[model samples]
Target: MDMEYLKQFSLDGKVALVTGAAYGIGFAIAKAYAKAGAKIAFNCRGEKHMEEALAAYKAEGIEAKGYYCDVTKEDEVQKMVADIEKELGTIDILVNNAGIIKRIPMLEMSAEDFRQVVDIDLNAPFIVSKAVIPGMLKKGHGKIINICSMMSELGRETVSAYAAAKGGLKMLTRNICSEYGNANIQCNGIGPGYIATPQTAPLRTPGHPFNEFILAKTPANRWGTTEDLEGPAIFLASDASNFVNGHILYVDGGILAYIGKQP
Candidate 1:
């Protein structure tokens, strides 16, 4: 392998702003960026989560800055981005990883509940991306990675709102690429499969029906880990994927491709 070719993967000295990185997938990606030599900046809506996230980064020997901001609010997102530019330099990469999911059957889900999910999952990405694009244009290149989901493509019971929001997010990712590719900004998404996180621990418990269902559906016969997503995230955010635009890299343990064995 050519060592020179591998240099494209290095994120040395780049500034990365990963939203909702206080924990879980966002945290994993932020940690990976720090390891890959990027300056890490993350946002949390709550002060408690911000404190914990900073401490966690410290424990990992990473010098990360955490901000308190509500991504769904455009003013707050803009302010946070401005602060990041001042403190960390122009953001070279952005991960719209902040989101929420509310599982409720469509018929029973109230309009308020639906709007709340859409506001966080779909609209906030728009607000945050908008805030950072100008800086990216000034810097000459940028990468925007949206944290999509399996629901982006498939619709299941009790997730009408989530599916709708993610589907919209998928289109938003493409639209961003269409609008910004000429400016050297690559906008893409990562659709995660069943990951074993705290929120899903109950479903992942041995002998749980949902667990068996997911295992049967996924060709890998297992759940995905946050670690499984790090490489793809880095690839999209680094120089390596400069030409790869408007794409959704599904890190789903093959669930999206498998049809499952016959009952």
Candidate 2:
């Protein structure tokens, strides 16, 4: 590969803040950024999570800065950003990866449960993004990557609240791009397919109905891995994707494009 082409992907001297990065997909993305030469910073909602994340990063030989911040709380998010700026640097890359979902049917789900989902998934992204944009504007360049879901584009059973929040997130992604693209800030989203993670291990057992359904629906014939998202996350957060704004890169192994085989 041309050195120039590869150089476009380098994130040296950049500071990245990935929310909810204690483990799983968010952790994976943060690791990738660290490997690509960006300074890693992450936030979790509690001290225990922060301690675990710091240990994990240290074990990986990454000097990551961890913070305890509730992304859904605007004041807390602002304070965290200020601290990150003071301790690390202005955030050049912001990954809105903090979110929660309640797998309950719409008719059976309580309004409070629904509100919690939206608050974390949709409103928190807005809060964090708002907090960081001014600094980005002053710096004259920035990347905001929202960790959306397949639910952003499609609905599934027992995930009504999740779907609603993700769907709203998709629009928010585009609107951020519309409002800031001219200012050299690119806001995009990543919609992951069913990824094989510890949280989803039980559902991935062989012969399980949900496992079979996922495999059948995914054209790639398997669930995705955290590593599967690393490259896309890096691209969206790097100079390589400066012009790629307002798009949701569905890293779903063609599940969205396929209609599935006939039974």
Candidate 3:
């Protein structure tokens, strides 16, 4: 690789916008991008939490600002992206990390619940990508990383809606890659294993069957930490992955590979 190839992995002077950046995986992604020298336009639903994330980033001496956007709302998302570009310049790196995962029985899930999952999980990436693509095309380069889930490929009993949405996200990532690859836009998906997010705290209790089952299924024998995701996030968002398009990179601690057969 040439010197330029090495610099491609450096995101200095790049502008990144990460949604759901208040906490969890999204927060981790934003930090990773910032650490890679990209300025951040972090998105959160409200002001206070947004302030917290921005403050934290500033403490790292990274250029970062927060925007408020309810991703499920079309107008809000469009306006938010527009404002980010206006204020932060061209969005060179866009991480579609904001997603919601719910555990509800298939039969018990309402039409509204299913729609909500689709809106947040599958549709939000499309919305943000749609808003960011033109600028990227104009610049002739951009990177988009969608936070898909292991459920994108596998189905579980209570998470049918989440599974469907994540599955759709994986396909959506590839579809966008196909449509925009010639435009120098790289789109990819990241599938994380069962992570120890606040949303999954209930399962973190001792002897929680949910936690134990996930651990047993995963070859790494541990719950996924947000810290486990930083490096992949940086690589995908940086020029390091310039030729990597439509790839579904699983950071699953070997869960996807094991297939859960008791040996």
Clashing pairs in 1: none
Model 2, 170-210: lDDT tens digits are: 99999999999999999999999999999999999999999
| Candidate 1 Cα misplacement greater than 4 A, ranges | none
| All candidates: CA RMSD (Å) | 1.0, 0.8, 2.2
Candidate No. with top lDDT: 2
lDDT by candidate, in order shown: 0.94, 0.95, 0.87
Residue 99 alpha-carbon offset, candidate 3, angstroms: 1.5
Model 1 is weakest, by summed lDDT over 10 consecutive residues, at 252-261
How far residue 183's Cα lies from its native spot in candidate 1, in Å, is: 0.6
lDDT of 3 by residue, 124-198 (tens): 889988999989999999999999999899988889888999999999999999999999899998998878888
Residue lDDT tens for model 1, 1-263: 89898889999999999999999999999999999999999998888888899999999999999988999999999999999999999999999999988878899999999999999999999999999999999989999999999999999999988999999999999999999999999999999988889989989988999899988999999999999999999999999998999999999988888789799
TM-score of each: 0.98, 0.99, 0.92
**Residue 263 of model 2, lDDT score:** 100
Q: Pick the candidate with the highest TM-score.
A: 2
